[model samples]
Target chain A: DQQVKQNSPSLSVQEGRISILNCDYTNSMFDYFLWYKKYPAEGPTFLISISSIKDKNEDGRFTVFLNKSAKHLSLHIVPSQPGDSAVYFCAADDTANTGNQFYFGTGTSLTVIP
Target chain B: DVKVTQSSRYLVKRTGEKVFLECVQDMDHENMFWYRQDPGLGLRLIYFSYDVKMKEKGDIPEGYSVSREKKERFSLILESASTNQTSMYLCASRRGGSTYGYTFGSGTRLTVV
Candidate 1:
């Protein structure tokens, strides 16, 4: 079963436009959420994160919004650039049980067209 | 900076052969994990170690095992390789502090024939 889900397999947006990637989770114990970006050859790199305590966290052009009630979170990038084209993954972790287990989404491939 | 290094970038092996993938991290994090990435199946954890000589099985650990004799080093072993095992393997480390995340290695693409 897919505990965490990213329904959109691919997303396309024009440069200087807004790009949003959405993720949903089934398990409610997850308190920490993270977003990762992956290129073709390299491993996934941490992009941004948000805690369960807050609803939104913004860093420069990247922002993450979390809604605890709906078990959903999203990543938004403003004025998207060509360099931003890559696969994005959403990960959720529950520290209450085994702090090590993290459930990840299938990933959304975002292509920012210039 | 925290850097996680994988021993190989690509590997090809035959079925039933033993395969070893090594990972080393510069950061002295207490937690190291092994995950596999496949098409339509983002990343699935195989195993992890919180301390030296300590190991825990993650979501998918049936065909794999791990060894962590040193703090900075972790190894994933495939006792009998299979074609379905062909996928990208990733290694990551997280500090014990509440930071609660990981620094990842480049990745290893393994193909079993």
Candidate 2:
């Protein structure tokens, strides 16, 4: 069974509009979450992350919101730029493991139209 | 800056041939991971290591093996290549525990003919 899930396979947004990417987790054991943006032929780059203790974490134009009660998380990119297009992956870590091995979601391809 | 380097950008091997993919990290990360990404299937972890000479099987370790003899390098080996194994392989490394994020390398596109 997939513990971390990103149900949306693709999302598109107009430039200067807000783009929201949603993720859900079934494993309550997960205590940390992260988002990574990947471009073709390259590895995923770290975008933002949040600990289970906090409800939200924001960095510049990127914001990650965690709703513990709903077992859901969402990433919002305000005024989306065309350069923001890529495949975004959501990941969760098992707190007990000191190795930082993560469970990853399928990913969502986001396209920003100019 | 942290950087993970994969040895090959693209490789083509014939069926039944052995293949090797290498990854090196200059960031001195204690943890290294090998993952394969397929179209629509996403990234699936194959193997990982936390320290030198120590390895662990991830979700899908079949037909694959890994070695970490030194702290700076990790190698993934395919005993015998198969067409089904043709996919993009990613290597990543990170500091210990849940505090930091991973630094990944440019993927290697392996095609087994």
Each prediction's interface RMSD?
1.5, 1.3
- Model 1 interface root-mean-square deviation: 1.5
Clashing pairs in 1: none
Clashes of each: 0, 0
List each candidate's DockQ score.
0.67, 0.77
TM-score for each of the candidates: 0.96, 0.97
Q: For model 2, give the RMSD to the true fold.
A: 1.0
Expressed as tens digits, the lDDT of each residue in B1-113 for candidate 1 is 66999999999999999999999999888899999998778999999998999999989999999999999999999999999899999999988645477889999999999
Model 2: CA > 4 A from native: none
Q: Give me the candidate number with maximum lDDT.
A: 2
**Evaluated with TM-score, which candidate comes out highest?**
2
Interface RMSD of 2: 1.3
lDDT of candidate model 1 versus the reference: 0.93
Q: Indicate which candidate wins on DockQ.
A: 2
In candidate 1 chain B, where is summed lDDT lowest over 10 consecutive residues? Answer: B94-103
